[model samples]
Target chain A: MKRTDVTARLLPKLVKASASAEQFAPSNIALCKYWGKRDAELNLPINASLSVSLDYLGTHTRLIPIEGQVDEVWLNGQQLQPGARFSRKVSAFIDLFRRDQTLCFKVETRNNIPTAAGLASSASGFAALTLALNDALALDLPPEALSILARMGSGSACRSLFEGFVEWRMGQREDGLDSHGIPLDASWPGFCIGLVEVDAAEKAVDSRSGMQRTVETAHLYQSWPLQAAADMSKLQQAIQERDFSLLGQTAEQNALSMHATMIASWPPLLYWQPDSVAAMQKVWQLRAQGLELYFTMDAGPNLKLLFQRQDRDVVLQHFPNLETVEPFGSE
Target chain B: MKRTDVTARLLPKLVKASASAEQFAPSNIALCKYWGKRDAELNLPINASLSVSLDYLGTHTRLIPIEGQVDEVWLNGQQLQPGARFSRKVSAFIDLFRRDQTLCFKVETRNNIPTAAGLASSASGFAALTLALNDALALDLPPEALSILARMGSGSACRSLFEGFVEWRMGQREDGLDSHGIPLDASWPGFCIGLVEVDAAEKAVDSRSGMQRTVETAHLYQSWPLQAAADMSKLQQAIQERDFSLLGQTAEQNALSMHATMIASWPPLLYWQPDSVAAMQKVWQLRAQGLELYFTMDAGPNLKLLFQRQDRDVVLQHFPNLETVEPFGSE
Candidate 1:
């Protein structure tokens, strides 16, 4: 096929100019981390993962179609340099929705969560970006379709289309037709997330490349998908039963299991810092002293603590220095 | 039997004082890391591991029998506090040689390696100490017996008794009588080690407690011992065949597999720092450019670069600021 042939075949010929649209998509933390991909091109995960969407931390994306030939991207009040990795990814994502093959995009995104610090900022960013693009182009695709497209930008971004407890099921197909986020709950009462920043600096390894390396080299990575699948069901059952203790314990273990693959990667990737250790120790101590809380971290030194919203005062008291994030519609 | 009665039965009757003796023991780096224990009290490993002893980094110890009721211990020119945890461990280790329960001795030690920065300082220290104690008291214990005693002090310490390639076989006995280091080679020509100090501080989690937690909580730990056993045989074959590439690849993978258990620990014990990641990246880059070297780390933030002695200058060139360690009889 010629250079523009695929675009012509996939995209519409001549469409009227479409107006701009904006959408707010909240960030998410995977209770069961997605560590590796089966197919990198399609962004298919090796295992299923469950996550809780944050009420506050998110990406607000504004999308506009222009007559120009190339997509323009600006993030966090600064225009991304042309040919940058992120700019290229954003451009590629918009390229997917080429209803008007000539419609270039102007994308301005602002994220409340720190980028690449393991808060799944890319998830929220792509989710909102995909949502706004779909709306702006009058595609009116369902949320599941939006999630599948958002996943092309970043694998875990699939979970951000749904609120509360969401599971990204790794579909049983070569083409990944069935894979998408399933909302397990609209809301889980008394659930809260505490963000403990162990280090604010950018990670040495990005989650994508890190997980790819793990999948390629780590021997332990071979055994993780089976356990992760088991954890998905276990976590779902705990959610249905409202078993906080079981849910928290399984979530914590699943996160650690995901990290175990990274740690066994050739050259190894260690994400926890000294303060990350201290915070976990404090959580254990608090649990011993009759508090209900557990912690999970994803590819960064920061720890996201899970607890009951009713115990917010006590939980926040223990982490006086930490920034806290509550679930949507929580007191 | 009662504790005191068993102690009395284990100890020999009073004998005449014996002459003092000195011994030098080298530290070892596990190619296949030992992460868990079958018996905590006996220091029996969950898996067999292969290691290479370093030439320069070791502990030199001298022992002398004395009339005092309590053992006198001095380390690196300073007397360790009597009731400190290390002092107590050393004392208990010496008690195994108690021909006279009231017999006391003076022990002096010096280590070229840092104590707890994952250089296996305790391995070398206790290995030398036990060797010297066995010599001084004229107990004439065989090297295997000495290794067993060394294992009592620190699990991996047993590997330090032998020169060159060593294997600490995780024996199947509960009494741990057969768990000892088997010397694989007196020397292997051209094999060299380059020490890169990522962080020269004591680890937040020591290997013993760290492995204890890993064994208790990490689900992956259950699967590691089997892999470790297979690696042990593969490493021994690589050593026997003198296949540098195969040996290096297996050693590197073994170290990472050991670390995999720690990453799945309840709180997770991460031993790498940012610079550690940098060093590892450099190693991978060097390898892609065709350098014959691999990295293996213990329980701390240092990496041991395995290479050929002829490539010492080239390896040292890559890490000018980092300290390097040469083989015992390298040119």
Candidate 2:
């Protein structure tokens, strides 16, 4: 099914623009990673995933209705050229909302995440863009509808729509209407995430292409759906019970399993740098010494450490430059 | 079936020792790795494996009958204490030969593979020791029988009995008589191996325990037997056809797949250090620029680069300190 058909079915036929709209969406780190796709066109996942939203480190997007024929995209005070990949992607996403009507938008987005952290901004970017579009057009769609829309921009963006613990259910439908993020009620106040920046360089292979290549060439990827399902259940139980050990272990293993598939792929996709291994070894060494620290990695080299508030000082002692974030703390 | 039972069925009922005997055996690198074991006692593999023997980089052993209550073991000019793990293992292997007889021998062995290369000496060590014992006792066993005996000491040691390409067939039987290395008739003269040592430190987990842990804990290991089988066929075909690309691609992919299973295991086995990753990235970058260089890693941080002789200059230029070995060259 086409993305336009899904959007058309959910959105109103006629909508008037509010003067302007602004929205904020937090970035999310998947505890159970979303690796492969069941439907690439609609960004439908092959397996369910769970994540924790970063409280204050995210993206802020402001949308203004414009009279020009083309959408103008600006990021961090710099306007993107129309032919730039980032600008083109934003324009395509905006096109889905302004079908048939001659509507153009001026999009301004700023990410609060530190550049050295090497975190992907697409998750929060798409999520915030979707929310701003909904508000500017006076669509007033529910959270599920907004999440499904954001997912069309980027798969992980669906999880970024919610706060605290969120689960993206891989729905059993061709249209992908049921697949959206749901926020879990449980929250641990002292839960911490330590960002260890290994490298700030651009990735050789983006996650979208990397996921496709792994699904196509990695024979061991056959077992990944089952792994994701098991990890998702474990993560949910850990969150509900506040079991830090279970949470940390499951998250670390889940990330490693995802990376295993990538490494086993043909032409091998390795996103780790030398410093990435050093950081991981440091975490493992500290854990062996009874510090209770575990780490998760995405498609990039940086590591996101999972620990509690009690062990924060010790973790920082080893990783002196670690950027600490309390996911549940008041900003 | 017990290892002793297998040995008893193969060896002669009575044998007299020679005054002294010496032997030499080259080390072998697995193109298709021998990973999981079906029978730990007899060292029977779960799947077939293939390897190429290094021409001169190997082990030399001298065995002399001595009048003593216990055997004395010396390695590289240093006498090993009886209680040391290496000494105990060597003594246990010797005990298998003198079942009912009270025969003692002083054994001295040396490995020519440079210490910094971080290659596992067990394959060459056991193969040389087995050959020397056969000559010392006047057993005069066939190559298959010798390969089978060497396997009981270390699984990959079976392949070290041959000079060029070898295949260790995973025979189906309770006695494991048919499971032995056979030298292939094909030869590729230009084949080269470059050793890139990342770290020479002791591994946190030995291959024996690591393999056991992976088989028990890694769900993805269920797919390994199938992968090995497929890679073994491809490698044999590559050798016969002398297809450099096919040989390099299959070997590299097979090694990565094995590491993938370890990474998917609980408590994740990662042998690649920071420098290992850096070396791998350099290889990939060079390959992208039209240099046909590929790499394979065993259960360690070091990488063994596979290329033809023509590309040696370019490979050496990139890795200045690389230890180059022409596996098929006359030493």
Candidate 3:
């Protein structure tokens, strides 16, 4: 089904625009990653995924109805050219909400993390945009509807709608009404994430194209859905039981399995640099020396380390320049 | 069913040793790798594989009857103690040939390539030993019998028995009689292998244990047998048609797929060092700029680059310290 069709079904035919709206959505790191797409058009995943929001590390978007022919998009205080890729994407997503109406938006979005470095700035960007658009148009939709709308911008954006741990259900229906993010009830105050930035340069292959390539060519991808499903269950159990080891191991394995599929793809998508492997070896070495540490990587060279509050100093000692985050603020 | 059973069925019941015998066998690089085994005892593979012999890069072995209670084993210039791992393994393999006969022999072997660094030294080592034993006992065994005997020592040893392109057929029978190497008639004189040694240290995990761990723990391993079969067909076609691109692409992808399965396993069997990834990036960068160079890695960090003689200069220009070898002698 078309993305427009879903948006049209859920949104009102005629709506009054508010003066302005602002919203903030935290970025999330997937414990069970959302990889291959089941429906590329609607951005439906092949398997369910779970993630934890990075609390304060997120995006803040402000939307205002503009009396112009085209949408003006500004990212991190810099106005983007209308022809720019990021501007085009934002305009296209806004078109879904505007529908037949000739309404233009002045969309200004800002991310706290590095943009397009696989830190998932897009997740919070799209999510905050969705929430801001809902408020700007005076469309008082529920959190599920907002999440579904945000997913149209980027697949992982669905999980950014909620705080703490969230699960994105890969629903059975073709229209994808049921596929939305649900925030988990459990919270671990000691859960910490250490961002080891190997390289903040733009990724050579973006996640969308990479995912498409993996789905098309990788033979090992046949087993990914099963792996993701199993990992999702393990992550859910780990979160519920407050099992740090289970969470760290499952997240690391899931991320590695996802990368394995990419590596097995034609042309071989390896996002890791020499330094990336070095950091991984360091994590493995420290873990061997009785430090409770694990790392997960996305479609870029950077590593997001998983650990507890007690090991923060040790992790920082090894990765001296580590950017540590406590998802549930320090007690 | 067992290594001893296969040897007992193939060899003569009683044999007289000649005065002395010497033989050499080439090391081999698998285009389609033999990964998981169906029978660990008999070294029976779960899938058929193909490889090319490394011309002069191999092992030389000499055997002689001795007046001693136990076999004396020597590698290179140093005599190995009987209790050493290498010596025990050599003695165990020699026992297969001796059967119930109470005979002792002096076994000496030497490898041209680095041992236990994913260079497949054991392949040539066992193959040379098998040939030397056949000559010493005057067995006058056919090439198939010789290959089968070498396989009892190491799985890839079967391929090392032949020069040029060879295929090891993973047979169906429980006895594994059909599982042996066959030399292909086709040869490409310009074919070359460039050994880019990232590390010569003994592998952290040997191929045997790595294969077992992948099979038992990696969920993605379920696709490996099919991948091997498909890659084997492509490689055979490439060899038959003398297509360099096809040969290079198939071999590289097959190797990466094997490593992918290893990476997906629990504890993650990553044989790659930081330098290994750097070398791979260099190859990819060179390929992007219209170079026809491709690389394959085994159970260690070293990369064996595959290219034609025409591109040898360009490959060497990028990798200045590359140890170049013409698998099919330069015409």
Candidate 4:
């Protein structure tokens, strides 16, 4: 059946269930490391990372099914053709989860977060898809399991499956069935992080191609497993002790390590821009002058500054020239 | 006491000494991490480094006596002309080193090292001058103390004081008088390091400017002290164990960290060429397939791959496509 027909059929059902069902978008922060791909087909990581779902800075998506055999999925009202960039992955996602059901999805996605800005748009998109689909289908699977399925879509997506601090354990299981997201705790809300949106420009290479490059040519990727282990341990301890210093220091180095792997990767490309470096330098300079501001960058110029709420103004003043985006509502 | 008359007297001394001394030339490696001026008068590093002084690669120098009252130095037989691009620190080095001497010299030098290739030609040139001048003047400073003085000229030049492994210590005192070089060991044989030299063919930015850019803009430079400390410890362990895996792993990461700091440096400029990354990738690909081959790069396109002497052929066979240049005497 044509995608239009499928969407025509699925839209009615989606609207009835989610008259106001909103999708949530979250920006991604690379935790320990996710430099190489072990299974590109599955989008699995050689080493797992722990990340928090940024509830305030992500896309909110809602899916509505039409009456008849819904023909396709439409994102932001744009019908992607069969051979389109997102088609294979979206089709595979739908086919894997709703194989017996013929439903078209109207993915009304409002992205509060930037797309392809290296803040893990894929993570937010996939996690929102997982959440929206689960709500639409009424399939009551745990968030942990949903993330494992989402990992098949994008590796970092698994981390957004949890709230607060989370870890995607790099299970040694050969089938990769056991690798899934686990929350450090569903109850911790004091873990506050600020997003300093410097620039929201798209990157030259997306995460998929970037990871593939690292796996294919980064000789240093071989050492990532050991380093990730060390970093992960440090990250866990930092989170537990609420050590923002260690957290900021570790994240910056991990990001540097990831970029290092990229440079060492074949046909080496730099994911960083002059602005991105400038953003980081500005943060460092402010911090050096005794301002306790620690900044972490994902894959782009925008930075995630993790600090205590009391110090928000102190940190916020550092980026006074930059247009700031608050992570949570009302401060 | 004009420069010409000074050269007339000094050149004869240089000629007399050259006739009896064995000519030596050492290639320079830019530390990439340029610290503050040890003596703003004499450009120097806050720390020491291990540099591979390329024997066959260096400046051609002929010191000839000319009619002069004061000593004069010329590059490529040109009169010590004004506004010729060299390390700005050059002026201070000449003035201070010759402060006590009346020996006038007409020194001419032709360099093969790419000027401003972000590679330290000044380090090599001055180091070679240090050796050549010692031969000419018979000052007879010990190699260690000579290295200290050369370091006062350029940080990495001290690395040229020794043949094999070198460690540049970031001394505690700020005066930099204590800043000196120490050999890794007395008898460690020369490890096989393969070089791939690319002619940058353009006047590259000198290390001083590059470092000043780093100091002014690179917030990432703030992180280098910690990284250097970690690297120094790990490197010592690796050298002690003779563990190629650890050595390669640490060196590769250190080089990348150094580059990352550069990338993060503001007004960001890259010292790397496309070919530099390509060479890096080739090594990575070969290493991924279980080749114990390891690589490190200085400022230019040339990569120094530390391959086992026994497995050198095996490693070289993998990259039949890449143009490989053997070190001076390698058959």
| Per-residue lDDT of candidate 4, residues B203-305 (tens digit) | 4455567667655655445555555556677777777777767767766666665665555443344566545655665676687688887766665545667
- Of 3 and 4, the candidate ahead on TM-score is 3
> Model 2, residue A20: what's the lDDT?
88
Candidate 1 vs 4: which has more DockQ: 1
Per-candidate TM-score, chain A: 0.92, 0.98, 0.98, 0.83
Q: Per-candidate TM vs. native? A: 0.74, 0.97, 0.98, 0.57
The 10-residue segment with the lowest total lDDT in model 4 chain A: A11-20
Candidate 2 residue-wise lDDT, B1-331, digit = tens: 8888998998987777655889999988899999999999999999899999998999999999999788899999999998888888888898788887888889999999987686789999999999999999999899999999999999999999999999999999889999999999987888999998777344558899889988887767777888888899889889989989999999999899999989988898898888888898888989989999999999889899999998898999998888888888833
Task: Compute the DockQ of candidate 4.
Answer: 0.07
Model 4 chain B lowest lDDT segment of ten: B13-22
Query: How do the residues B129-157 of candidate 1 rate in per-residue lDDT, one tens digit apiece?
Result: 98887777666667887888788788888
Candidate 4 to truth, TM: 0.57
Instruction: List the pairs of residues colliding in candidate 2.
Output: none
Deviation in angstroms for B178 in model 4?
28
Which pairs of residues have clashing backbones in candidate 1?
A190-A309
Q: Give the runs in model 4 whose Cα sits over 4 Å from its true position.
A: A1-25, A67-70, A77-79, A114-118, A186-192, A196-203, A321-331, B1-122, B137-331
Model 2, which residues run further than 4 Å from truth? A16-19, A200-202, B16-19
